[model samples]
Target: MTSASEPDGRRQGASAVADVLKALIREVPDFPEPGIQFKDLTPVLADRHGLAVITAAMAEIAEGADLVAGIDARGFLLGGAVAHRLGIGVLAVRKGGKLPPPVHSETYTLEYGTATLEIPADGIDLAGRRVVIIDDVLATGGTLAAARSLLAASGAEVPAAAVVLELPGLGGREKVAPLQVTSLQTV
Candidate 1:
């Protein structure tokens, strides 16, 4: 019986829910590799609305994202749902050795020389497609930036990147300044 404009208390509750979810995120020291304090989103993902709210926010920011590219691992969880909401395709940007034959790859600098990312040529047709890269955290921005480059090589247009959390102090923002970046929670 409520009008569309009428504030649905339930829907309005999403923000509050997001705040708590943000709090639930745990910091794991030296995970996946040393000197990296990974922002573990598993706890947040376990909550129903936590995941729903995150996906909805990412979708809203994506606006006209024709495709959603999730950087391997955690990125998949967010990207898959956002792709569903947008009724578009999802692309997976994986580690060097993950993709099968006919894959496109790009290499970016690490503290060392470089690291590589790959995307299956058949994963998604990037010709004239506009994609939004999604990830759980924007740390050094190397992975996300590399993913963007890989998508472009496939002939896709990447207008933005979205993450659940962004570590502002890490200079990740400066690395991706050219792209529209959005994070539900920034630290």
Candidate 2:
């Protein structure tokens, strides 16, 4: 339904949307802890244009996915929007113990501590589904990697992951090795 040039045009569009996101992100230094500069995307999501831009761009990247997997909190927001755009469903990948028993969980180490991601082991079978993981940011890639594992365990083929922003030094892209991660913006 589109020409080869369409991909390039889409890339340009995504780049422009990323520019919009960069302006709206709030930089908070040393809030939760020392030596951590948190990139808060609340303001970006709150903006009418920001949300529209990101959702569309991410949806484009999520073209072939049958389902969208939203990691914990923020990913829930992006996943809903992107899935809606794609006319598909969004899976809420929750924090450990949030869901009832019989859940599939993958635990990973974080910079501060350890965390786990869980999904229903039953119901809404994810078997053979092509899923794309959406998250707000990619830091250490621990969370993303865990989510990929959880989904793969559920029999879903996680072909790709997308984030609103990616912190370069964290080696997040490398951490989720071979699983393509598309960061709308990097800072």
Candidate 3:
């Protein structure tokens, strides 16, 4: 069990870690399209100390989760590490048509068009399992919202969502209002 002083100490340590991560993040202009500034975390992932800080913070927030539902690609990076730290399994939330069998899906509005995400029904047996949805960025919250719905619809207990960064202008929190949302950095 952690002592009373542990939480504060952890916060201080996590903040230091965030500083290192922030420094490693690269500013990539017009990535995937034009008129968009992307904060690439690839460098952060490459840094051992940065990764340790992030994983520790994630594990702390994931205190009671039975499973970590990682939302495709980048989420897998954070989720895989967090799952290892927490000694839990990871359920992948993938783009539509990617799963092999008995998949469940949810669709949401995208900046251009509608997008769909899928999760295998047997992935995490939602019956009474505690779930934490993780993603790399919370831009419009459409993907994460869909992921959360898919998890809940599949019978998983989704109480919270986690992300490395969140764009407040996009109202990502409102999109996943049914569940608590946490982000390491806000932009």
Q: Estimate each model's TM-score.
A: 0.84, 0.91, 0.89
lDDT, candidates in the order shown: 0.79, 0.87, 0.79
Model 3 lDDT on a 0 to 1 scale:
0.79
For each of the candidates, give the backbone clash count: 0, 0, 2
* Off by more than 4 A, model 1: 1-18, 29-38
| Deviation from native of the Cα of residue 130 in model 2, angstroms | 0.2
Q: Report the C-alpha lDDT of model 3 over 1-187, residue by residue, as the tens digit.
A: 1111122244445466557768988999998789888899888888887777777776777779999988889888889888888899988889988988787889988979998899877635677789998788888788988888888887788888878788899888888887788787787
Top of the candidates by TM-score: 2
Q: Is candidate 1 or candidate 2 better by TM-score?
A: 2
Q: What is the lDDT of residue 148 in candidate 2?
A: 97
lDDT at position 112, candidate 3: 90
lDDT of each residue in 98-141, candidate 1, tens digit only = 87888998989986679889998874678999989999988778
Best by lDDT: 2
lDDT of 1 at 137: 86
